[model samples]
Target chain A: MRTSITRNRILTVLALAGFVVFLVYAQTNWDAYRLRILNLCAVYTIFAVTFNLIYGYTGQFSLGHAGFAAIGAYAAALLTMSPEQKAANFFLAPIIPLLRDVEWPFLPALLVGGTLAALASLLIGWPALRLRGDYLAIATLGFSEIIRVLFVNWQRITNGSLGLKGIPDHTNVYWSWGAALVTIFVVKRLVDSSYGRALRAVRDDEVAAQALGVRLFTHKMMAFMLSSFFVGVAGGLMANLISTIDPKVFMFFLTYQIVGITVMGGMSSLTGSLVAAVLYTVFLEVLRPIESPFDLGPLHIPGIPGMRMVLFSTLLLLVILFYRQGLFGQREFSWDGLLNTLARLHRRVTGLWGRTPPPSTVEKGEQ
Target chain B: MSRKKVLLVWLTLSLLLSLVAAGPVAGQEDEIVIGVYEPMTGPQAAGGELTMQGVYLAHEVRPEVLGRPIRLVLVDNRSDKAESATAVQRLIEQEGAVAIIGSYGSSNSMAGGEVAERAGVPVMGCSPTNPLVTEGKDYYFRACFIDPFQGRVMAKYAVEELGVEKVAIIQDVAQDYSVGLAAFFREAFIELTGDAKGIVAFTAYQTGDQDFTAQLASVMAKNPDAIYAPGYFGDGALLARQAREMGYQGYILGADAWEAPELIEIGGSAAEGILITSHYHPEAELSPASQPFVELFMEKYGERPSAFAALGYDAYMLVVDAIERAGTDDPKAIRDAMAETKDYEAVTGTITLDKNGDAVKDAVILKVEDGEFKYVGTVKP
Candidate 1:
C-alpha cells in the first residue's frame, strides 16, 4: 500500500509535467480553431468536475447549471466590457446607471461572477435541499428556465435576447485549464476529507446519516455552493471564449450537456469526468467531416446536417447500455493499479508465474 | 463480466474508431474554395437550407471564377453562436476559403462576423438584416437591406399608401432581427407622423412561443389603424390568425421575414391583406439578372425562390463579381474590390455597398391575396 501511494504521486507529477509541455506547444502552434476546441475542453472539464462533485459525491441531482452559468456569463461579460462597448450594445434600451460605466479586469470579473453564483446557490439550495432525487432535478430545472427567461426579458441589464457582442476575449488555454485544474483539485480535496464522508453517508442512506448526526442539509449546501462557484467561473470563461452571449445561450440544453458529461464519466470518479469532458469536446470537433459532403464510391452522399449530433447521441446511448455502471464506475484512476495489471499480463504471456493468478486491483468496496 | 474486460473493450473500440476517422481529411488544390457557414440544422434550419439552395443554384449557373472551378465548402453552424464562430474559423484556417458567405440569422452573422473580422477574411451575408451584422466591421458584408430600411419601407407604405396613422408594434424580443426591425419601424412611423403617440401599443413575445392571444388582445384593445408585428414567418402567421380571430379589422403589416410561403398556408384567410416588405418578387423582374435567376431557380428546384433564396443568389454572384474585378483569387484583393462595389445588379436588386458594408437596395412590398403573394409596387431606397 505504501509503495502504491508513492507510485501514484510520482505518476501524477509526471503526467502534470507532460501536460505543461503540451500546453506550451498548443499555445505556440495551434490556430484559433484548434485552440478554441482546446479551450472548450478545459471549460467543460470545469463543468463536469463541478457537476461530479454535486451529483456524484453529494448525490444531489440538480439541473440548475444553466442558470448559474448564465448569471456568471452575464456578470463577467458586463463587468469586463468597456463602457463604450456597453453603450453601443444597449443602443435600443440604455443600460442601467449602475453598470453603464463599470469596467473590471477579467480576473476580478470572473471572481465576482463566481461569488454571485455561490450566493444564488445558497438561496436555491436552502429550499431545494429538502427535496431528494427527481423532485430536486425538476425544481432546479424550473429555476434554470426562470433564469433564462429573466435574462431574455430584462433588457436593461442583460441586453435582452439581442445578445452581447465584443465580449473581451480573455480566455485562452491558460485561464481555462488553470481554472479546470483548480476545480478538480478543490473537489478532490473536499471529497477526500471527513466532510466528504458525511456527504457520501447522506447519499448512501440519508435517514441513517441524519440519525448519525450528519447534518445533511449543511453538507449538501456546502457541495452545492462549491460546485456552482466553479460552474459559474467556467461559464464566464465560456462567455469570454465565445466572445458573444445571449439568454438563448443558457437554455436548458446547456444543463443537459453537462449532465450527460457527468453521467458518461463515472458517477464517482473526478478523473473520469476530466477525461470524458476532453473526449466530448474533441470528438465533437473531430467528427465534423462525417457530416460534411462526402463521396462514397459511385454514390454521392450529400452532407446531412445534424447527423453529427444524431451519431453522438447514438454513441452515448450505446455506451450507457454496454457500461451500465459508467466507464469508470466507482473507481478512480491509480498508477499502481494500471502498472500492476500490465506487469501481470506480461508475466502471464511469458508463463513466468507458473499459473499463479495475479490479484485483481478492482476496488472491492463500492460506495 | 469483469469490469476490466469492459474497459479494455471500450478502449480498443475507441482506438479503432479514431483510426477510421483519420481517413476523411482530404485536401483541395485546384478548386477555388469559397466557404459557407450557415445554420444547416437547428431552429434556423429552414432558412439556412433554403438559402443554400440558392447558393447551389447560382453555383450551377456560374461554376467557375478566375478560370478555376468554385468549390463551396459549407460548414453548418448548427444555429449556435459558439459553433458559428468556430465554423468561420475552420473555414478560413482549415479550408483556406478566399471569401465566406453565410448566416441567415442576425445573431449568427454578428457572432461569425467577429471571427471573420479578426481573421481578416471578408464575409458576404445573406438575409441577416440587422445593422449589427455589418456595423463597424470591415470584413462582414451583406447583400440584403438592413432592418432600418425594411422598417422604413413598411412605414412608408403604411402612411403614403394605406394612410394608417395609428400603428401598434408587437415584436419577437427573442430575435435581434425582429426587435431591431420593430424598433426601426416604430421610429420611422413616429417620425413620418411627427407624433410621439403615433404608436398606440408596443408589445413583445419570444421566439418559438406558440400562443399570442394575450399580446393580440392587448394590441386589439388599442383600436389602432394597423398593427406592425415584425417576427419570423411562423410567429407572423400565428399572430395574423389570432388577430383576425379576435375581430381585429385593421391591416396587418410585417417585415420581410414573412415572405415564406408558410405564412399563407398557416394564416389561411386571415393572411389576406397582410402587407409584407420583401427583398424580391419572382414575377417582378426588376433587373436583367432577375429573370434568368428566377427561371434557373424554378427549373432547378421546381418552385419559385423565396426572398432568402434571392439574397443567397445575390450574395454568391456579388462575391464572384468582386473576385472577377479584383483579377485575383486572393481574399484581400476580393475584399478590396467588393468594398468598391457600386450599382452591382443581382437577383435581389441593384446593390451598392455603403461605408459599413451594407447593401443599398430597393424594397418590394408583396400582399397576400387568394392564398398567393401578389406583387405590389416597389419602394425605392
Candidate 2:
C-alpha cells in the first residue's frame, strides 16, 4: 500500500512536469492558429468536465448550458470592451449608462461571469430540478430559447443581434489550462466526497435516497450550480480568445457540443473528459482538410461540403452502439490497471515459450 | 498479432497521406501569395461560392502582377466568426500573404479584419457592407457601400419613386445584417416623410422562424402603403409568401439580401413586382471595362452573377490595382495605395474609397419580373 501511494505520488509529479514542458514548448513553437486551437481544447475541456459532473455523475440532464454560457459570455464581453468600442458597435441603440464605461481585466471579468452564471442556475434549478428525465430536458431547452429571444430584442444591452466586437484577445494557454485544472481538481474533489455518494443515491433512486434522509433537491442544485460556474468560466475564455461574439454563437448547438463531448468521453470519468477534449479538438482540425480540395499528383479531388458532420456523426454513432456504458464504463484510468495489463501481456509471452498442451487436449486435437 | 499489424499499417498510411496533403512550405520566393477567406461550406456556402467565382475569374484573367505569379491561398471560414479569425491568422502568419480578400457576411469579415489589423496585413472585403467592419480599423477596406447608404437609397426609392408615404417594417432580429439594415432604413424613412409616425408598424422575428403569421397579422393591421422586409433570402421569401397569403396587396420593398435566386424560387408568384435595392444587376448598363467580365462570368457559370460576385471580382481587381500602384509587395505600401483609390473602374461600378475605407458608388434598383431580377434604375449616393 505504501509503495502504491509512492507510485501514485511519483506519477502525479511526472504528469505535472510533462504538462509544464508541453506548455513551454507550445508557447515557443506554435503559431497563432495552432495556439488558438490549443487554447480552445483547454476551454472545451473545462466545459466537458463540468457538464459530466451534472449530467453524468449527478444524473440530472439539463440543456441550458448555452444560455448560461451566453450569460457569462455577454457579461465578460461587456465588461472587457472599452467604452469607445461599446459606443461604436451599439449604433442601433445606446448601451445602458451603468455599463457604458465599465471595463475590467480578464480575471475579474471571468470571476464575475462565473458568479453570475451560478446565480442564474440558482434561479433555474429551483423549479426545473423537480422534473425528471426528458421533461427536465425540455424545460431547460425552453429556458434557453427564452434567453436567446430576450438577447435578440434587448438591443440596448447586447447590441441587439449585431453583437459586440473588438474584445481584447486576453486568453492564452496559461489562462485556459489554469482554469481547466482548477475545474478538474474541484470536480474530482466533489465527486470523492460524502455528498457525491448522496448524489449517486439520488441518481439511482430518488425515493430511496429521500427515505434515507438525503435531500435530492439540495444535492442536485449543488451539482447544477457548480457546473454552471465552471462552464461560465469556459464561456468567458471562449469569448476573449475569439475576440468577437454574437447571440448566434450561443445557440442550442453549443449545448449539443458539450453534451456530445461528455457522452463521448465516458460521461462520469474526468480522465475520459480530458482525453476526449484533446482528441475531439485535434480531430476537428485534421478533418478540415477533407472539406478542402487536395491534389494527388495528376488527379484533383474536390471536397464535399458537410462531409465533416457526416463523418463525425457516424463515428459518434459507432461509439454509442458499440459501447453502451461508454469507453471506460464507470471506471477511470489508474496505474494499477496499466500494471495489470502489462503483467497479463508478460505472462502470455512467457507461456508461449514454455507451455505445452495436456495429453487429453492433444488427443482431442488429433481426433 | 495480425490485428496489430493491420493497425500499424493503417497508421503509417495515414501519416504518409497527411505529409503529402500538408500546405506548401513557407518562403516560396517566386509566387506572390494573396489569401482569400470565405465561408466555403456551411449555411453561407452559396453566397461564398458565388463571391469566389468572381475572384477566381479575375485570377484567370490577370494571374500576374509585378512580374510575379499571384497565388491566392483560399481557406474556408465555416460561416463562423471564430473560424474566420483563425483562417486570417493562418493566412498572415503561415501563408505569408501580402494582402487578403474575403468573407461574404459582415460578422465573418469583421472577425477576420481584427486578425488582419493585428497582424499589420490589409484585408479587402468583397461583400461585407457593415460600416463597423472598417470603422476604426486602419487595414480593412471594402468594395461595396455600407448599410447606412444602402438603407437610405432604398428609403428614397420607396418614398419618391414608388410614392409610398407610409411603410411597415419586418426585421430578422437574430441577424446583424438584417437588424443593422432595418435600423438605418427606419431612420431614413422617417427623415424622408418628415414624420416619425410614417413607419406605421415595426415588427421583428428571429432568424430561423418560419411562422410569421403573428408578425404579419400585426403588420397587416397597420394598413401601410408599402412593407419593407430586409432580411436573408430564406426568411424574406417566406415572409413575402405569408404576407401575400394574408391578402395584403401593398408594394413590398427589399434590400440587397433579396437579390438571390432563392427569393424567386421560394416566394414564387408573390416575388414578382417586389422592388429591391442591390449593388449589381445583370441587366444594368455596364462600363466598358466591366463588359468582358460580365460576359466571361455568364459563359463560365451559365447564370447571371449576383452582386456578391461582382463585388468579389472588384475586390480582387482593386487589390491588384493597389499592388501595381504601390510598385512593391510590401503590405503597408499596398494598404496606403489602396486608401488612395479614386474612380477605380470595377465590374460593379466606378469605386472611390472615402476616408473611412468605404466605396462611394451607385446602387441598382431591381424588380422581380418574369421570375427573374430585372433592372429598373440606379440610385446614386
Model-by-model lDDT, in order?
A: 0.87, 0.85
10 residues in a row with least lDDT, candidate 1 chain A: A358-367
The stretch of ten residues in a row with the least summed lDDT in candidate 2 chain A is: A358-367
User: Residue by residue across B1-381, what tens digits does model 1's lDDT show?
Assistant: 565565567556654543443355445467788889889988889999999999988898889988888988888898888789889999988878889999988888888988888888889999888776787688889999999899999999999899998989999988878888888898898889898798999999988899999988988888999999989898999999999988999999998888877999999999999999989998887688999888888889899888888888899999999999998888889999999999998888899999999999888999999999999989999
Give the local distance difference test score of model 2: 0.85
What lDDT tens digits, residue by residue, belong to model 2 across residues A1-367?
Answer: 8888788779878987899889889978988878988998998899888888998889999999998888888889999999989999888889999999999999999989899889989988899999999999999888887888888889999987788889898999989999999999899889889898888888888999999999999999999999999888888998898888888888888898888887877978887788778767776666655555666687776655555556667556656776665545566767766666676668768888666442231111000
For chain B alone, what TM-score does every candidate structure achieve against the true structure? Answer: 0.93, 0.96
Looking at candidate 1, what is the lDDT of residue B361? 86
Clashing pairs in 1: none
lDDT of candidate 1 over A159-218, digit per residue (tens): 887889888899999999989988988898899899988989988999999999999999
In candidate 1, stretches whose alpha carbon ends up further than 4 angstroms from where it belongs are: A297-300, A348-367, B1-28
Q: Give the TM-score of candidate 1.
A: 0.95
lDDT, model 1, position A318: 63
Find the 10 residues in a row with the least total lDDT in model 1 chain B: B17-26
The per-candidate count of clashes, in order, stands at: 0, 0
